[model samples]
Target: MTKYLVFTVLYLAMYAHAGSVVLTDDVVNIRNFEIGYLINSPHTYTIDEAIQAEFTPAPNRLSLPSNQLDIWVRFSVRNASDSVIACNIHNSISYFNRVMDFYETRNGVILDQKHIDLFAWTGDTKLLHGTDSVLPIHLNPGEEKTYYFHFVSPAYQYFEYLILDDQHTLAELSTKNIFPVLLVGMLIALACFNFLLFFSARYKEYLYYSLYLVSSIIWFVFEYGILSHYFGIYGMRGHLTSYGLLSATIFLSLFVKKVLQTAKFYPLQNLALNSTIVLLVLNLLWGVVNFFNALDISVYFFIYAIAVYFWVSISLMRQGNTLVKYLLAAQLFFIFFALFGILFYEGYLPYNWWTRYSIAIGVTVEAFILAYLLSHRIKLLKVDLETDSLTGAFNRRTLFDQFMQESKRISALESLVFVIFDIDQFKLYNDTYGHPKGDDILKIIIHHLQSQFPESSVFRLGGEEFALLFTAENAAAAQRKVSDIRLAIEHLSLAFPESRHGVVTASFGASVIESGRIQNFNELYQQTDARLYQAKHNGRNCVVM
Candidate 1:
């Protein structure tokens, strides 16, 4: 009776000591765990050694520093159902560099074992699928098993484990992966659109934008494990990620320079942007030879680049650049999310959907905004090309084009008047005063002309010479308008020390195309030129009609 009692006591003690977890649902998140780590050590731990080693209770999520270390994590689960159930043991973190070995044992007898090393090149195509990292576990009613995970990595690690039904796990993983796939598709589409715009418009900025988008797509493909699923090459993931990011940065800097015309307007910012590009290129090269150190150094450059871009954008906006304001708003939105992503990666924030994909979201928003901004910029550039730089009036080319268009609609009901004017003794005035003062005089003349003929279109044909085209009811009305403008110029009495008048004046020549006249723009221009020459000969301050 004493022997039997001792045997019963031993059996009950064994049952009580078994760390079995009863599963009540399709998914079981095993959070109660313990972890032990060995730094710069060989992978030679046996089951007994692992069991005997000291382990501390892990937090809700385990994070390991980036180092050459091996980590051992222990956990157990039990089945409470009447029938046997098959489930998948999933390590939720899918970082590419990790080499994971899973060992399953029940009552000190090994039941199954599996190894997942993504860096290995020799594998079946399906082996590269991210889901293959999960281990298969079978449990009979009331059976308990302990699982040991031996993880080794050369990069920082995050750990979370789940016990899920095979079907449920597949469904969940597919649903979870859909988001990244959609993001990739969106990025590719945007890149293609920008490429098309580049070729169609022949704008170099669009080309740079497309290249930046392409690089971002490449980085996200590897970062999100989509490349691993298709290519099964994990060794290049880090290198490619670094290369893509650096390339994207370089192209983005170039795009900003072109879009903002930084060389012309913001020379200091341009120099800083170029310097960042050089640093990024050097960092990319270093990453090819020594990855971890390069990665560590790159973070500072990235921060610097972002700061410079932000500061330059703000400065431009403050200088009354309308396009830069839009760009600044878009960049602010992107920077906010980018900072969140950085904080999440550094373990300062919880890993939620927004934190996990914040950078991607920011990139999408920025891409769209940038594309719209580029189109708007193209329109503004067209306008600027048609305008005279010295005087804010239409250039000779634009004036001729407008005249031709207006000529097509000439009729008896509408009369056209063309007037040419120039500053009197302007060459002598320019010779006496430097070109800087000459420019001021020209600007003042344009301001006065625009103010007098607010409804007419004015054109700066050449130096100190301007033309105005207006619609009038009759020749008398057009003559009256030209006489008023000539009198206004004489009355201003602008001081010109070298001129005989001692005050700046203007000479005007007017030509009227009466109703039913079908004169071409060049013919009208010739007539106006002849009259202007006559006016110049008949004492420089008078109007010739």
Candidate 2:
């Protein structure tokens, strides 16, 4: 009786252990569950069928207990050759086991995976179930059963919070695209503005700015994939894109060359231009190599920009014009943008669309400034062309243009006064202290005549001679003004140290239109010339009226 009783107790204990539950995450996008109790021995059971369902898994997310936090996760078990494989998981944290709930009343292994509310452990963590053949319903070869499961931890859920991350590269591209358009519009506007300035000013600086603006637009189009995107230049993508930097280098080099005009100072200006041409051709060849090899020519852009800025600045400082000072300002801006691109590519700064496109802003603004400076330079040059360089007075060409218009006024009136003067001993001064010192003496005489005619106008009529047309009370006041001019020239302190005449002096003569006696200005001009010789013959420093 004792033996029988012991056997019964042993059988009960074995039955209880056999009915214990076992679960596992298999090689599928779902979880597998099985009952460890196998009443029929040696029975090969295939997966009867599979069905997809939805349910909330039990939550055990809190550290308090397994049942404290509801646990669930969306999962699927895909067909894997002859078995089921569970996958489609996030590796944000680590690989972990998933828990799955099956609708018990379903015809087959129905898995509910709608509400994920659980934490599954993986790696070296303790498992919730044991490995047993009874726990896993095996399938035949070339057959599969799919199911759903949840992945969650039995205890901490907040510590395993899901982190949102973007996965679509197109989204990033579109976002980047928005910024480049704004930059492109700004650059185009800048170029157009400079074009307007060029038309308004007609200065060479604007010409250079226009060239740079064109190069920049081309560069930006190349940089943004626009060549491929809009222009369908993908077949020539390698050639087009690689040569963009090279073209920018060349156009900008030309701009700098024009901006600084260093050749004006350099004894070998043409030689420098030739060498620069060679460098440009070399850049083009390297660009071809880069296109064939997929090697980025971005570094060349930097090297060329630096080289250009250095050369331009040096040239401008040496012998550049007013436009050069402004170009030098532009160089600083260009260098700043180039360095920014360098730092970004070197990993020293974050690469961003705005950071890349902002170079257009610098170029646009710098071009505008250059355009303004060039326009001003053009105006200054125009003023110079109409004035005498040595005497700082209006030249005879300007005087003649004014004379034709003034003749009408004198012809309308009953009287007018005209005078012509020649420095009597200027030739002696020129023969004495070389031409440069003679030039100073002529300028001194011009200044004296100009100051003496505070209300009248005086003009240099070529070397050592001058003329004036004035309205006076009578011919006597005009003759007095002429005498005053001669006396002023004689009083100047710039004496020729070796003049045979011993001192500088000038003779003047005046003519008056009395009762329309001067029918034509040509006759009046000849009469004044005859009187001028009489003053010189009467001795220097005197006026003949």
Candidate 3:
């Protein structure tokens, strides 16, 4: 819809001269439009007044034929206070050539305008029902400026409009038209950035975030007239429909669960995750139902989706961490107006443009989530300081911690064995094959030994040698297991050209203790180290006690 809309807007702007709003001395009369709100006092809206919204050029309608826009409106900010007070202009797009599309989630609904025929049939820029929102500007104190708005008829909507006479600041300005674009920019940027991040990290979390961004961007496109503008979304007025909204919602929910680590935290969180899955299932069913029933349930679908999203944000906030709390706060930042809009569309309440940007608020929360995860990883990196970079295994520093653990376990159970193994000619291999190859061989051997001692905790006692500590029922069993491991290594097949003995081989030593063993691991180590020396003295490929 965009291509055509851009083309049409451009063609109209180019081939035809658009009517300019040139302000005259004191008053200005719009030729082809209506002046519902004046520079002194713009349009005022109150539900008690039957929602009177005055349009310019009378009748509050526009017919843009070859750049001749028949509809227009003027909003004038009037300082109606003792001091310079800020005012605002707000407009709601009520009707457009909306092509409906439906999708299901939670066995209910998911609304994405792109599912409409217009998305598939037309360009995104076409003049469809511009579901876009605009910002109602907050005028400065005592400022008097008339802002004019014009739109073509089919893309025009006459909804409850308001020129706010509040003391709002620039910070409190509500985005009307540019809101969607800013949201789209945020979502698209997030999508592209996270998509690339997934490529870099290649983790499921990144994929979830990336998908969330993508869904958000798609939603932006669907929400704005972009999809309908070109696709003529409503073209399939009587066909089957499904929604991309389900994918967006489900992925968003899943991403949140994963990021917050809430799924495994409690039964309720788990239940929420499961329920979201169910919602997704139900949503799919409804999507199918809507596909066949035309685009009938689109509005209901979104209403439910909005509810689910809001629930997720609330749930996250209730978790009460700084990150989750801030996330919730960010979501709440946009949710009030969104909920208000829901009230508007549901009842006679006027739609709030603020509500339309719930997704933007969502993006903010998600971005913060991303930052939190990154920082969390950084914290973990600091704690896991004793790991080999090449193999990611515990290094020398890890042994000190392990030593204390083994000490406690040994004192409690008294049925533990310690085994020490040293490569027979690791230095020779290293010299012959180069240091890099030697490092590779050591890493492989470490991996093999670590897997071999299934019941034992293996630790690298610096280079070329490793130690294991484990509990067994008896000394005999422990010795057998240790011997068997040596035999397995001797018999193990490997590809090491520098190895002297057919394959890489190591000498092993074992010491079994039920009681009256070495007082501490250092003494126990001395005993085992002696045994290891005995093995090397006796023969290379054997275990000794």
- Note the clash tally of each candidate: 0, 28, 48
Candidate 1 shows a clash count of 0
lDDT string, candidate 3, 406-491, tens digits: 65666544666778888878888787788898788777766776776566676667678877777777877787888777777776
* TM-score of candidate 2 on Cα atoms, chains taken together: 0.54
The global Cα lDDT (0 to 1) of model 3 is: 0.52
lDDT of residue 347 for candidate 1 = 57
Candidate 2: tens digits of C-alpha lDDT, residues 1-545: 99999999999975643312222324222222221111111332222322222333321111122222323322222233543422222222111213323222122544322322123222322211111000123333333343322233222121111111122222322343455556667767877876787788666556666666676677666455454334433224323544544555566556555544545554354355446556666757765666533224445545655565566556656763455676667667766776665554343444344454456556665656666655666667776887789997777778766666565666443456677887777776677667898788777777766777676667778888888777666666666766766666666755655543556877787887654454576777788889889988887667878
Ordered list by lDDT, greatest first: 1, 3, 2
lDDT of 2: 0.51
TM-score of each: 0.80, 0.54, 0.40
Which ranges of candidate 2 are over 4 A from the true structure?
A: 1-209, 224-244, 268-274, 288-298, 301-308, 311-323, 345-347, 351-354, 402-419, 447-458, 468-481, 496-502, 509-534, 537-540
| TM-score, predicted candidate 3 vs. hidden true structure | 0.40
Report the C-alpha displacement of residue 276, candidate 3, in angstroms. Answer: 1.6
**Candidate whose TM-score is highest:** 1
lDDT by residue (tens digit), candidate 1, 353-408 = 67767988888888788888888888888888898888898998898788766666
Against the true structure, whose lDDT is highest? Answer: 1
Comparing 1 and 2 on TM-score, the stronger one: 1
